[model samples]
Target: MKTDLYLDMDHLLLLLLLSSGLQAEGSLNQTDFVRLVDGNSLCSGRLEVKSDQSNQSWSSVCEDDFDQQDAEVVCRELGCGAPSVLQGALYGEGEAPMWTKEFQCGGNESALLDCRSSGSDRNTCSPGRAVGLTCSEPVRLVGGDSRCAGTLELKHEGEWRPVGESVDEWTLEEADFACRELDCGSAVSVRRQESSDRSVWSISYDCVQSGSLRECAASDNSSHWLNLTCSDFVRLVDGNSLCSGRLEVKSDQSNQRWSSVCEDDFDQQDAEVVCRELGCGAPSVLQGALYGEGEAPMWTKEFQCGGDESALLDCRSSGSDRNTCSPGRAVGLTCSEPESFRLMGGDSRCAGTLELKHEGEWRPVFDDYPFWILEEADIACRELYCGSAVSMRREESSHRSVWSISYDCVQYGSLRGCAASSYSSTILLSIICSGLLLQPKISASSSMDGVSEAKQQGLLVFRGSDFTVSCSIQPQYPGGSFELRFTSSTSAHTYTQPAVNHSAHFLFPAAEPAHQGSYSCVYHVHVFSHDFSSESRQLSLIVVDPRSDQIINNPSKIIITVVVLILLVSTASYFYFKQKDVTVPPTVGSVDLQHVQSW
Candidate 1:
């Protein structure tokens, strides 16, 4: 009983054992001994204290340096057993117990504790910083607390409230800061401060659901919400918005249909709900739809479009509205578009015609009708603003109605062509065309000039180009042959030139200085084809006498020179006659010479 012996299962075990019984027992049995160690050459294995594993487990100064000491201290404070008395960590020797040190919530010299749950956060030092709930003392919160997920009521003047009505997104930062500053664990409940007469700028916002306040609105305008710029989007019309926590829902109409409000977006939502209740959600395609939104009123077949950019087209065609097209002719098809669509005035057969459905008949809105009906029809066709048709309906015996127009829509031209029509209808109808209406619509058109506008400058102009002057639409000029008359105060009176080219520039010779005053060359434009001549722009040439004012009296110089020559000739002739016995000749000269000499 005093000696112990055992078999060596492995060679290493045999090598480790002693042969003698007492010696082997001493070698294998547990030994009770105490080893004192200095700070140097300490074995890596954890050294645990064999005392109450409280603060006293280690030297007060060495306590922070040992994991076992930390664990012992933490376990004791957490109501665990003595450090060495309890089973080591989990197993006796191999296990290294987990040591979690806690740091205080706030202090000038405190470490930030990584936390998980509320309990763990308060007691343990986690590896990662985890966000969780925190509660304020006294439990006075009515709306919410630091739960991070639950509702938090914000109280102003001792009244608790929910977060949404005045909440945008920034509620957490502002309210949380205020609450924590005020020592309320967190501002879980955020409510704007309200007043009996609230200024548009005074109401605060709360966004409990979103991550941030700016995220509630667009990034461009997030500050408005933070700054509480409610008035920027609101107005006080004889009263206030959200009076006594009740918002007003007023009713109005758009396109002759009732809606909750005038604003398109707001009213549209209300419209869907309201119209749905009235069993008028959206009309189905009766025939089909063809609408257009361009610079002018026109029809296009597009069934899958219902947008503000385009008018809702209600269209149908009967059999007769096919290839036979005329300006004021009736076709057996019709399309209902928006209000702003109008049939522009032009002389086009298929393209410019407007056909509306009256009594199941597609009638063209010609230039003859009251002009308003075709405009209204255009609106019905385009679902745009309604402008009166400039040309519609035919007084011709055929009594046809044509509705072809264009609109220059200024409001949405950047998105699409800007066109306008002023029409309204209680109900909208899609297009219904006759079998004859199978003819394709006229292709997109240019202006009435019938020329490519981009390439051609202005209208059909012939500047400095020759044009034969032959009469067609107009009667032959007076006596048939064209006459070019030149007139001016200085030029010949009514100087008539013959019939010439109808071009902008003329082949006529240059005018004399006398003819330069207000002399204009006007060619008749229409006169080339017709008897009535449209006058071309007057081409006037101004004659400027660059030097006439500077020539100082040339006529007097010529007269003086002639007088000097005559006197010299007379003097020479008198001297010769006196030598040749011309006393008689000298006598006459002497009478005038004597008076000069004697005087």
Candidate 2:
């Protein structure tokens, strides 16, 4: 009938086991729990009716044991199940619970000795006839025990009730017994009365000595039973008059009290939440007591959700992080106020208004929204470095969102020269192709000053003069400052200087034995001013001595090397000295080396 009962009950019991299926002999299982509600009965008029089977009801185990009868009782009440059968279901406190102890009640659900039923109902056991079978002497038991409330069957009324005083009928001996049973401090005083009708017994004992109260000692007669009352604490009928819920120690009592302070009251932290979400109200938590005693102390809750008040619910995080793992609320010592922004053009990417993002989501950036503002989002979104924002303007027409600001970086060239995007501003797209695409043509040539005999020169030159490759590079930028470097496959190569601006040239070392063989040549150059340097176009050179027999073996490469060498040598001589020396002598018929040169 009441939905929240189960909800609360489930919450209370989920942490505890409902029952145990251990050995039925020594072990006990609380498969169900039951509680009593007034106006309970097995009748149609008092019942709620429903067609759905799930709407069935039940009664306590004290009511009936037969399944069919129980069903009838449940049907009559229109409840899910019988209350008595489910009288002692398992339950515990807190999120994770541990069930302790068995049922502690006098009803059928409890493990207490069943003594309430009559005669043959429980094998014909009559309590009154069982002479002198009473509770333990000095029934000063814990608050949870049956002896907690003294047990006395009054002779006059023939009914069981806690000992108390009534003027019409009572006795001092009975009162003394009551005191003795209750363990009250002492028989400090007494009250006597006459009895005739014998319908009920009247006796009283005062644990707390206030007036001429019937203060009688139930147990430990010397010690007073401070402030204890019968009708107040335990009833002769239902017990637990002082408290009705499960008896639990005040465990973690101090911390529980602290946590409960202002738990449902207006939270001061709410203001911090407001500040975090809306961004404008950048206030910290108002700690300490608030309206009531210990009410509304606060801690700073954090998140990047946004600066809008709507952000409060989830305003702790920003960007994709908000989408991941429920960026619920962040807690912090302090937080910065979110700035605000608005976009102008239709092509703007975000959802309507512009947002300053941090952590995860967007927050309002401070709106100095003008034509060309310094807002980072503005620069990134509009894709422009028209440097040093020109102007700023707020769009008055758009109000569903806030106003927007624009910016213009000073023109650095094209978009390629100045990278940009709505989400990033640090990227640079300087694609200036200043590097010269060059072909390094290196040539090496060697010659004996006056020797030239194609075949003979090729065959004999290596034995006579060592070959050299004077690698001279033509200027992609003529006369450009350049390093004349060389990387030979086999030689320890060196360069004069880097080709600054462009062309480069290097003279091979005078000559080498390996010069007759093929060797690789490489030149390195700087391609971009902002970028890394470029590698030179490599051209292989085959050196042929002026007198080498292998002249035509690699003639083309040789000629190329020779030409490059000639150019380098000529250029070097042209720059180094005014002119090369030369001498001429008279000759006749060119055949007198043996006869004429003897002198």
Candidate 3:
């Protein structure tokens, strides 16, 4: 019987492996393709390769043969900046089909295929020899609320170093070059660093307006750091309209400095402020660094807005904490106008698949785009004046006409500002919205009887006990249904039931650790063929282990009761003795009755 059980388990494991459909050894299909896997960013990952007729598969490369030049080629080919770290198997080991070929790159090759390679078979390489890399961004801004304005850091020798302090007088010409190098509009102001921080002044550079910073002469003198501020300018990039596109800002007018705002610090209120600042109406949609990643300098400051602020700078900011902005979190915005996008074919006007109107034709948005997130859903719901997004789903496109454009919304803003491009896909997104008026109230009880005891008992249950959670709608609407949802830190479970007289109950037969979580219910009803939903207040349930209850309630309760009785008796004895000692000192009128009783 033991042998049979082992064989059954082996069979199940084999079935799982087969069902996964992982490629076989050396079965890659792309002949001239390269990609990174299992790493956090585009620059860092385990390297993989493929040739024509073979699918892209994990392959091994010798660490000795892989150099910084070869890694730079790979980074450039992948549209990344430069190589930071190149190590074999640093990301993880690869499978079969090791590329034992000897590669030689000159560090300037546009594609990895352009580099010279000595053909060799996979047999020469050993296991765990796959190459991994970390790439450095070409440019970045530091220490500012806007991306276009900040202390500039440039990548040199695979390390990020601040530009050298000016030996000659620092001029606006050099500052203009730096701003132009970052693709920002133009230079606004140039200022010298007041403090002599040697760490930041490791290298000093003398630059001219026509040449790149790399061509500038370097010195070892540790003096002041050069800080450049670009002009106070704002523009929308990568969109068709002047009011829409990726949002870029320049904070300082004296030192014209600009930087991309991070999505982490942006929201709908911020979008509204940006629109008003740009002389536009309210924003229709807002997205986070979806159009494209900005250079290193990001606006790390957090903005606090009430959605009525006229300017972004007028809102409160998190001062001096610029580290909150991370790479690839730039903000995007799309302002409300006559020619924007809308939702169609949902349970209500507020809920449905996204559609953009262009050239007098409505086009469907493809759901397969990777950038769709909760922030995008929130922006969409808000655009429709809906309360909030309850759920987002992908479904097959009902119509044959697909929108030629794709959007990326990382955080809040107008959807029009999201980077748009031509794309094709068969699936489309469907969004569901819940208005504010439909919020439901949920209660947990020990039993389903009309008189629930759990409410008085704080909704606490012992392990192995049974409990019930009920949701009721006040001034209940007819033809509504209830959907119960349970959510814990790690997992979520959902159940649905038809509402009986405006109430629905969920039962848990045996409470356990898995059942300990906050539960909520939604009351969904169809009115005028539109779906309306109300969510209940969250009900938290706590389940105590039986052993813990025993330890806390049994011997501990007995000890407490015994101690209380002893204290009571001692107090009574003390009072009696005190009365006995005061016999002769009583007042004459008051003591006569006591003396007659004694006689």
Q: Which predicted model would earn the best lDDT?
A: 3
Q: Is 1 or 2 the stronger prediction by lDDT?
A: 2
What candidate 2 gets wrong by more than 4 Å, as runs, is: 1-439, 447-491, 498-502, 508-510, 516-532, 537-599
Q: TM-scores for all candidates?
A: 0.17, 0.18, 0.28
What tens digits encode model 1's per-residue C-alpha lDDT throughout 198-265? Answer: 21221233232222221222112112212111111111111111111011121111111111111111
Task: Give each model's whole-structure lDDT.
Answer: 0.24, 0.28, 0.60
Pick by TM-score: 2 or 3, better one: 3
Can you rank all candidates by lDDT, best first?
A: 3, 2, 1
Model 1: weakest 10-residue lDDT segment is 436-445
Which residue runs of candidate 3 sit more than 4 Å off their true CA positions? Answer: 1-232, 235-275, 278-350, 353-414, 418-441, 445-457, 460-468, 473-497, 506-599
Candidate 2 global Cα RMSD: 33.9
- Candidates 1 and 3 compared: the better one by TM-score is 3
For model 3, residues 313-342, the per-residue Cα lDDT tens digits are 678877766666655668878876444577
**What's the number of clashes in each of the models?**
93, 97, 44
lDDT accuracy of residue 36 in candidate 2: 23
